[model samples]
Target: MEEDKFIELAKKAKYASKKIATLPVGLKNTALLNIAKNLKENQEKIFEANKRDLEEALPLVESGELKQSVFNRLKLDENKMRDMIQGIIDISNLEDPIGKTLLKRQLDDGLILTKISCPIGVLGIIFEARPDVISQISALAIKSSNAVILKGGKESINTNKEIMRVIQEALDSTRDFPKDVLTQVFSRDDVKNMLSLDKYIDLIIPRGGNNLVRFIKENTKIPVLGHADGICHIFVDESADLEKAKRVVIDAKTQYPSACNAVETLLIHKDFKYTTELLKALEEAGVELIAKPESWHTEYSDKILSYKLVSTLEEAIEHINEYSSGHTESIITEDNKNAKIFMNAVDSAGVYHNVSTRFADGFRYGFGAEVGISTNKTHARGPVGLEGLTIYKYNIEGNGDIVKDYVDGTKSFCHKEG
Candidate 1:
């Protein structure tokens, strides 16, 4: 597609988003239920498309062009489809974000001011081989009343098109939402077109490796809502409970080694007398420590780990500030004072205490499901959930009042409660 064409489509989606923002919660729920129903009804078709993608991917994997984990995340099964359906219904049960009055106050004379939640217009999502992300992003965008355009990787083009077809069918059945509100571009050239549609795309969220995020940041003028990597950390304070720390660290690192929130660096408060034993336990559990004079600055996404011994709270703070990817950081401490200090000092989107950093998820946070975990401070910070998908606007009300009386200092400002 040409750049101009995508810009035009994005404009239409923005126009559609305006209408979607005001849609009733019940109506949105109905659309979500219908989507779930359709997906369940057409399981065989979805699996067939997935099979083709898997077969084509096998040769690439055998040639060492694709990782097994990437291939697994790409190939969809019945459970993945069910999970996607449940995620849609889960968003349906959440409260409507639009028109939520976050703040209300009275101005001079009779003028009233209100700040409320509203949609951020159209969003562009570019993700890797996870074909199920198509539904996940679509559900969150619609629930929050934001239109979305998806650009999945070429490897999952066939699967993506199939899922997009099913979703568009559901949207078409509604007849109110524009079918173009959900679009999937198969061509790599379409990414350039998407980047050029900044005038209509309010935000660009890339869910993939560092190179893709860097490319989007450098090439696009639109706001990007993704972190390059998750160099997360877990600090064991001197006042920490040794047993709890051991369990949480195991869950954080060994539970799922490939995830972004998995612990990449371990910081030990030097006052902790059992630091050596803790390190030994981690090594016994198959964590290959990648330590040097300054290895704490590294992020290990594989079986690798980094060890750091801190003399004090200040040293732990320095390590986190020096190495963290600003994603998720946790502290395992029983002392309230130390926990407060660490929470205040760690510069991350998620600050956990007495818990694993792996718990940093949209579902775990009780927001249904996550489109992606974001480290951006402006739009979204932690899990990009339904609430994160919305931005607020001011809604003013007045009883036949104008700014003329207040501007000249002719009227005094008064606070009133209704």
Candidate 2:
């Protein structure tokens, strides 16, 4: 599409977002349920479209032009379809995040103040291969009363278009639901256009590999909320339980190797007695361990893990803090004090103890689904859910209150919380 055309769509989205912001919770939930129902009824159509995408992607995968992971994500099955539809329903069941009273205070008689949660207006979401992200992000936007413009990977173009069609049809059937609340764009040029439209796009979320995310962040002046790397880590303390360490590390690295929360690096205390056994166990589980200094900062996103020997718990913490992408880190230890210290000092969005890093997910955290994991220090961090898409506004109620009277001390002020 042309740049001007894209901007026009953005303007419509901005207007629609304002309209959605005032929609009652019941209407939003009804729309979500409609989407879910429509998707369930049209599952075979989606599968047929996914089959076409897979057929096109097969040659690219074979020629090494496309990643096998991307291909795998593009090929949706019955299970994925079921999960996607059920995810929308689950989101509709969550508490409405908008219009909640965060703060209420009384400054004086007949003067009250309130801080109420509200939508962040229009969002521009750019993601790769995973067509499921379309449904998840669309559901999140509706539940939170925010508008979204989505750009998906070319590899999943057919599947994305089909899914979006179903979603739009469902919205059309629903009463009082704004169809412009969700929009889809296709083309590399669309991404470029999206980055430049910070005036209409309140937040830009890029969900893909390190290179893609880095490109988006470097080129956009908009407030980009995402992590470029998923260089997560796990450290095994000297007091760690041998069985637990092996179990957790295996799950973290081999459960779903391509996941962002998968552990890419493993730290072991130099004096830990089970180092040799743990390494052997990981190798048996199909994990290739690399112990080079250069591998510390790598996010393998595969069955490859970097290993290191730390002399102390503090050294382990320091290594993780230096090398991790601030995504998620875990410490496996029996010592409570070390666990507390590690959790406090790691400085990652998710710090765990004696558990697999794979637990670092929004749906697992019970937010139903997430837009994406944000490693940013400000605004939303971790798995961004419904609440993350909202900002708050202060509403003050007063009957002809004058600021001059307070400034002149003619009226006494009482600041009290309710």
Candidate 3:
């Protein structure tokens, strides 16, 4: 019975997805701006709802039923609330991602083939905590012209419900807006149903810890887009400036230790002159540095950092490629030659030089917001924004075009690339 209900809901979302796919950019922007306005107006109610969620989550955190990192994400502070509203408005200002011409080719004398960007039907979003994500994802979906079914963890159910309520009310108030564009589902069974109905859910985007992403990858036939771990790394080359290296490393790890982009591993060239000072600075910054550990794949999503000394830049790149999560990696160096080499050699979604890995964010990257940082080699990589959510379709225009005519040599394709 539960499966039937979910299937029905999925069908409606699929129907809604088609309707919104052709929506004009003005209407979409109106819907997004309304969502931002409604959220701004209902801040008090939303905070009250978040307070209830935090009250329930605290006991779980104390009993070890939930990690404190998750509790931090669960709590919706004033800054997060303000950012959430601003993100939606920012998205409304972004250029429309749909129906843009990607390619144009002359297939024949009168036949012209064009590739246009289009929505990717429906998106199934499974996230844990981070209720602020609801607004961001909803705004991105609206701007990208894709329907979404969001399944948030039970831990922040109250906050999720209230936020969704405001968003839905906003959508409802908008003129000529399609219904079922965003559906919020709960229960483990909803997850199972989402995984099973690959035809209905075009993509599965899981936003949470290693386990949740892995489980979605294992269970779903639908295409999954996300990174399981964020074992990011930062390497200090022999020519790295001591002061700049210290500042970048400190900000990367200690600025927001719980962030997925936070640097977890520190690598220093053996010949680096300021290695001792750099390590000392990190220790003074309250970072617990572990040296030469038994495992290299650990993602210490906390104040703890793992360190290693390598003889050369190649060794740092090699270590990063071996155990790094392919999320993000950065190199600190004054030598432009070595910096170029490090940036090219590191096999991660994001590679930086003379900067902190914390800059590997969509909002910081000026994408307004992101669905998530994807480590996948194909489709999309790094921070996935509006353009990432769209796929292209080929269309041919001709008075009379037949495959048989072209196959029989009566006519031929000009094959002009544009």
State residue 275's C-alpha deviation in candidate 2, in Å.
1.1
Which pairs of residues clash in candidate 3, taking residues 3 or more apart in a chain or in different chains? none
Work out the TM-score per prediction: 0.92, 0.98, 0.98
Best prediction by lDDT? 3
Ranking by TM-score: 3, 2, 1
Q: Model 3: per-residue lDDT, tens digit, 215-300?
A: 99999899999999999999999989999999999999999888899999999999999999999999999999999777899888
Which pairs of residues collide in candidate 1?
none
Question: Candidate 1's residue-wise lDDT over 1-28, tens digit each?
Answer: 8767767777787888777878877777
lDDT of 2: 0.93
| Candidate 1 lowest-lDDT run of ten | 292-301
Candidate 2: clashing pairs of residues: none
List candidate 2 segments past 4 Å from native: none
